[model samples]
Target: MRHAILITAYTDFFHLIDLTNSFNEDFDIYIHIDKNIYVSPICLKILQSFPRVKSAEQVFHVNWGGRKHVDAILWLCKQALSLSTDAEYFHLISGTDLLVKDLQQFCNFFDKRKGTNFLEYFLLPYQGWESGGLNRLQYKHPLDQLNIKELHDRNVYNRFVNWQITSRRTRPLPNYPIYGGSSWWSLTRDTVNYIYQNYNQNGWYDRLEDTFIPEEMFIQTLLLNSPLKESIVPYNLRYIQWEHKHGSIPAILDEEDIPKILHSCALFARKTDSRISKKLINYFNNNRSSNL
Candidate 1:
């Protein structure tokens, strides 16, 4: 099974390139660098070192908790699927992620379950949301309101969009049952194309184009509403320890977490920094399956 690994990266370009060194010739890697930040010449050279690496020519200045996050992902997927012909499986991971096993180990695992796709998905408003259960889909976050420039300065645009705001979404919501999950997954090439087509087809994409952190819901909602609903996996495959009660970034992996990561059956462990976790990364690199 040929693998197309799609990555979303903004910072830590050297670390991102180091992470890609884990996968060999068999895996084709495609990356989308956030346009908000700049990459130095040396780091960009390292990122393009491997022949399989494909970078997005048209990058987005993605804003946190903004719709551009989803757009960047779609842009990467579009490039990977278009260029790699034998692309059987597409894995979506972030810059902070490290592949914990050998490429062949992952290949053999997916080869057995050829038809199934692995993605964490939950029917939206499923009891956990305390404040706004279904309002995530109901509220409209305009592009101008969520722009990084506008919010970073915290100028009048921020004040104007706050309590004084007097606008509600004029567009009607899609009838599909909203789904929410972690914004990462391993999916089949066919399903990847399915999502890309459905989201760009017509009215559905427009309905939630401005939804809050649409990346978290767009793909989940798309998969659940389609025939692939039964193939969904309800758990995230990455072993991330969430120490913060409510924060977007997961706690960085430490040497103490090595045992758990090696035994969890998870293919990747994320938010890893090569600068800090050299001991942990070396352990996995040295212990990769000999069968590969």
Candidate 2:
């Protein structure tokens, strides 16, 4: 019943520590810290100190809506696959994510469904996205190389997108239908191996490099088109709120959200903060046994 937790983190070292501590010996944690942020040597050493924890030797800048995010994820997957061959499941999650389920509960959930792949997905031309999400792949996205948070850079990015749209410039769509959703997922070892093998052999890496937020689409599109699609459960097992708050897309969870979070069948919840989620984290810590 071994599991691998693959994490991509940028800030908040203390929260990251708590995240790793949540899992027991049955889990191996693989982490990739964003290279753009400065992390103290002691912090890095402390993270690596955990017996089953391994930090990625190679790091990436990990810009938002960038291919580097996807690259970081793939790199983590590669590291986990190479190091933890006996792991039955790999759970891709963020550093801000917290395990809502106890260790036994988490393992039991996955053990009962041995071959299932859990991810949230929707086909292309989804009404929720502008241009039905086609613009993400149909047009060239040079902004991926720049920081979208900077005012000057964001303006340039917006101008490029507008110009492309006005000029009717679009790259030819790939032959396969596109699918996308929340990037976090729990996948079986066989599915992960297939993704790694197929991605390397089919040259999807280069094709996805210039697309916007390819991380959300790459795995979904790849798996949905393959035989493994049948095994996909279509729920990523993470409870997340999409409302914009605290300057992020998914609102950071707080104590106010505790009831819903506890009630949900989700194994984890994301975008928590040490400061904002103090009460929520403490509740879990104090009530660990009762919650289970």
- Expressed as tens digits, the lDDT of each residue in 83-119 for candidate 1 is 8879898999988887787777788989998978888
Model 2 lDDT tens row, 1-292: 9999999998888998888888779999999998888888888888899998965443788778889988888898898899998999999999899888877788989889999999899999899877898788888786568788788889988898889989998898877788989999999999888888887435566878678988888999889988998999889999999998667779888898899998899988888999988998888766665755
Give lDDT for model 1: 0.76
- Candidate 2 achieves a global lDDT of 0.86
Q: Model 1 Cα displacement at 22 (Å)?
A: 0.8
Query: Per-prediction TM-score, please?
Result: 0.87, 0.96
Model 2 deviation from the true structure expressed as Cα RMSD, one decimal place: 1.5
Model 1, residue pairs in steric clash: none
